[model samples]
Target: MTETMNNVLNDDKKWKIIQGDCLKVLEGFAPGSFDAVITDPPYASGARTQADKQKSTRQKYSSMGDNAPPAFEGDAKDQRSWTRWAAEWLAEARRIAKPGAPVCMFIDWRQLPAASDALQWAGWIWRGTAVWDKGNSRPQRGRFRQQAEYIVWGSNGDMPISRPVPCLPGVFKYGNPGKRIHLTEKPLQLMRDIVRICEPGGLILDPFAGSGTTVLAGVLEGYRAIGIEVTDVYAILAQERIVRELAEAV
Candidate 1:
């Protein structure tokens, strides 16, 4: 699987997006193969009940009705199951990440506690949380607007303060992209900023490629990156979008 990844990266010197199960694909990497792990995994948190949790990704996330993007996999698990699965993959990601490598995982309020628990269970040093204020969301009659998601960030172990990375903000404000190819696509600029947590030119790993936003952002910011996506439609779509957008920027 890593060899296949290398072949893909050869087509574009700085980045690669592989189509596979991240759990299995991660096993192909050697210990300490990556400098950082940054990804927005499936939150599995858009529902109030277990039955609602099993609804399709599009049904849970999209307000566009029939125009919703294609549904993706791995977002239907219940809370316990999602936490266990998160810990399992996170452990694998840590195994491949260099010592002191930073990790940033995206989650919503419903799963924030679980995500933090899973991170510590996976053996990462729980650093702190960062906010991604989306700037707008549906206002409720009396409750506060659910207008933010969190990045649960940490490190493999003993991240030295001497690292050259900048002092990043604890909060980022960015609206969702006006157009999206995936059900939960992040803004490209948000990803570019997040990738800065890695040292300059370090390789970053994003286990959930979604629309390949992280992979593209990494390259544009002068770092190498690899992304793994399981859904076939998105794997193809991400590759095309990365190739086209990169070419256009040239």
Candidate 2:
């Protein structure tokens, strides 16, 4: 085991935020160390350039330009790159996740296939998919207004499985309250649902923990969370959010 893994094994804290590349940090964890995995990673939607500043300005009259920072610039281009990256992470997750542990990954419709393929290739049994319908979504120029995202749930082993809850569906609806810090911050309710389904009190891992939504959910649900964030800004924001949440709980 690596020094980082050793530290994690030694610590008994309920939550931790690790500022580093997920690929590197995942290497430090031992196989079957975590009980669950929930994450929202970059969609690799071929959106490298910043959004049009003028367009953004026109839409919201905000000082920030229309062209938001490219969320997937550091990663490779195309779905193939995303598939490979996700597969790599899933491989690590599978190793660190307990038998029959659930792994839930968030993705947009455009990238769902690749995400599913990546998870299957990484040895997870593709159980089913769930949808998050954000009621307050923006109007789309073409096609139906895109208001829904997806969560692909997989398991570490293949066998008869029990539903995490007595009654849960593959789809759910939530309001898009907008993100406070991260570009693609997931809703708290969504996180809460995932935690409820997965059950609490075990170590939950979020490899691409943007803005710390998953971590916050884990903390609130009484589960130990370990988050890895690539960007320094997001890392700081996640840590701040965790501290604030913990303080509020007291």
Candidate 3:
């Protein structure tokens, strides 16, 4: 749907989902409007094979094939192209993020450099990275099974940002022990941890809000969240998930 036509849901204190292209929706907001940003963007893991697509859509969590790659395979025409795309989104993120506000981008090893470079180019100073160890027991064939992901944190160089919690060192282990609705969906506990550490109150933004996990975390934590998703199917699913989460909260 066009940005103008996308629906914006208004609920109690919770941030609602906005269905549209993130770049377009974000352009309409004032600069430095968000307190913090916790997002998981697409890793550009290359084009999905028809079989890959089918498997992603149909396989149960327990039934995924051995050959299936991790949700994001770090796909791009080249490293340069990947950096360009990341730069575009990150620049916008910097514009909307308050001075010294923390911007957390979730990524894997393959895309970490590119994501970090984009953040630097967008004027955010590199602070540190957080490792989220997803407790998965599967073993890989050639390499060690990746049980973790990274979150790069940065802030605008010139301003004072709020640090709601003390920064913790070492990796954070989060267990995901159930069926998966969205491929590459992060656990809710992970999102909650990030939110708690960042302490975003006015609004939390997630550009690539797959399945609405981040938004749900924000809502549950008593912060308004704004998310953008390209696919209608995911947007619908995210909304449904939010409804269920809200219902459970009551």
lDDT of 2 by residue, 1-250 (tens): 4656736633457788888888888888877788789998877553534353213212322233545422322433466776888899899889888888889999888789999999999999998999898876568677687788999998899533464544567778877545456656788878978866565477889998878899898878878888999888788888998899779978
Off by over 4 Å in 3: 1-13, 46-77, 140-143, 158-162
Regions of candidate 2 where Cα sits further than 4 Å from its true position: 1-3, 9-12, 46-76, 140-142, 159-165
Candidate 3 weakest lDDT stretch, 10 residues: 68-77
Model 2 pairs whose backbones collide: 32-95, 32-96, 51-67, 51-68, 52-66, 52-67, 53-65, 53-66, 53-67, 56-66
TM-score of 3: 0.80
| Deviation of model 3 at 100, angstroms | 1.3
Deviation from truth (RMSD, Å), model 2? 4.2
Give the CA lDDT, 0 to 100, for residue 83 in model 2.
89
Candidate 1 global TM-score: 0.96
Can you write out model 1's per-residue Cα lDDT over 1-250, one digit (the tens) per residue?
6665444554348888889999999988878889999999999988998899889998999989989989999999989999999999999999989999999999999999999999999999999999999999999998999999999999999999999999999999999999999999999999999999999989999999999999999989989999999999999999999999999989
**Order of candidates by lDDT, top first?**
1, 2, 3
RMSD in Å for all candidates:
1.5, 4.2, 4.8
Every model's TM-score: 0.96, 0.84, 0.80
**The candidate that achieves the highest TM-score relative to the unseen native structure:** 1
What is candidate 2's TM-score against the reference?
A: 0.84
Q: Local distance difference test, per candidate?
A: 0.93, 0.77, 0.72
How far residue 16's Cα lies from its native spot in candidate 3, in Å, is: 1.6
lDDT, residue 38, model 3: 83
